[model samples]
Target: MCTSSVCNHTPKPFALHKSSSVEEYLEKNKQWSQSITNETPNLFSDYNSKGQQPHTLFIGCGDSRYNESIFNVKPGEIFGLQTVGNNLNLNDETIISTLEFTVLVLGIEKIAIVGHTDCGAVNACFDDSVYETLPKNLKNYLKPVYENIKKIKDVHKDDIPPIDKKQLSLENVKEQAKKLLSVDFIKEKFENNTLQILPMIYNVENGLVETIDL
Candidate 1:
């Protein structure tokens, strides 16, 4: 009988090796490319000739579990920008430039900030020991998110119960959504009903995506 709190199903033995070497991954990629080419010969050529006009800008966590397969988006359907914890720093040029290009140039009407449960980045914010071991650049990059989480914890300590990774993940998604709306262009577009920003949480356990009401 399975006794795990989260999962009730018994674990299965691995059919193939759990970890793959670089060459193994490359070989698998070759197989995938060939399979796709054989199944849809004109896919890439059609995308190339038509040019990309993705309707949504999806900002999500760098976690491999929060992938296109979960969102059900096909190739060239979404302009994706992934980062640690799905965080968006206003001063990040890459994020800013990507947003500008997607909205202003590509004319994407929707922006979704997606966070996932049990995020390492969100968990690290609660642990002082993790900060000490992280590289300086990464620590610096994630500082804002850590601070924001801390503020939320401090301010709502009375009303809110004990903070967990799931709650933090949802809050982070909402915070990132607010941050995006803070941009003048985004604010204007949102106010005029030309754009929509959604805060979403992806549950790795159940493979579910739920909207977080802000």
Candidate 2:
């Protein structure tokens, strides 16, 4: 029905459509894949023929904002393992297997444990309210990181002074790097200068990565 000037157009019946989020993602991915294929016809073929010879094992947080693009690395350049808080459990079979394969088989020479400023996981570790509200599995997963932070805080009880969440994020990166280096295989590689373990911090604000001494 039309009445006023604004209502001159006929009204269309409302119809339920597919989920916009899923549809949009699929559409965008389709277009992106097509564009890549058109721009570099042999990209995928080259990857298949050469296989993956990644030089770095980049362990970063699961946060979507942090990605391989941040390092300006092309596909197949880095084998990435993303976990919450960029945490790693050396005893976990999945992690151990991946590490072994990447180091021994793939011959990756560098392991970078990267954390970022204003990390939600780091904040949640110190915030009891948030920690209390997380799911049981997530809480268990993050428990080691929480305990590690607590230990760091305790060490700073004297004249060292307490640190904020950003500093804690850096400390978490260092702790995770230490854990990775403690593995016998990884330690052997390190002692022999076959492997390098780096603790890195990415500043989300400035898009700059700084290496931290472990």
Candidate 3:
């Protein structure tokens, strides 16, 4: 089990000067620790203290608006992995390691691949030309997203219709879910109904999440 100090839920904002960004974060963290402990002093205190056993695994975008706090869950209630586009690349060691630990070790049964409206990564993917100006690392990092969009268009061949970013974002959510289910252990568990995976989309304008039926 993890302590409230180990994971924060509600946050208090602090002033940040150009040179004091780090200092402000640390100060706010201190304040948060003091406040939450006062409110729920015994929160998560009676657990067995055996490492985290979060109920769900969330694959969310790295955007600040889409965070663990959005679900209104306790600090360790949701184990999360946030990426620029909430993508899943089987070749990535970090992704693979997290999957192995969560599914095989911690035994987390539920997973959600969440996307959101007004996503910069999905927008960049929709407009491939933007990639030309990006730095090498960022451009390479988003390559797969572009490739997926390309494949979607290529299927049309003759005249590719304009694709809506929101629709595309939804497609990306579905694609990531499919990618997660592609993993051997995850797929086997899913097939046997031991594991559950769902696709979700977060509406930035409304600050709500909708489940993708696919």
Per-model TM against the reference: 0.80, 0.79, 0.80
Please give the distance, in angstroms, between residue 82's alpha carbon in candidate 1 and its true position after superposition. Answer: 1.0
- Clash count list over all predictions: 0, 0, 0
Give a tens-digit lDDT track for model 2, residues 1-214. 6667556465644232355577777777788778777977787788746888899999998887786668877677899998878878777888889899999899999998899988887887666677667677755666766666667655545634557777888888888888887889999999999999988999998999999998
**Model 3 alpha-carbon drift over 4 Å, by segment:** 1-18, 48-50, 128-139, 153-162
Write model 1 residue lDDT over 31-139, tens digit each, in one string: 8767767877876678745899888999999997776557776577888999877878778899999999998899999998889998887777656577556667755
Full-model lDDT for every candidate: 0.80, 0.80, 0.78
User: What TM-score number comes out for model 2?
Assistant: 0.79
Q: Candidate 1, which segments miss by more than 4 Å at Cα?
A: 1-23, 34-41, 127-139
Candidate 3 lDDT, 48-81, residue by residue in tens: 2445788788999999777767788766678899
RMSD of each: 4.1, 8.0, 8.3
How big is the positional error of residue 130 in model 3, measured in Å on the Cα after superposition?
3.2
Residue 194 in candidate 2, Cα distance off native in Å: 1.6
Candidate 1 least-lDDT 10 residues: 8-17
lDDT of 1 at 197: 94
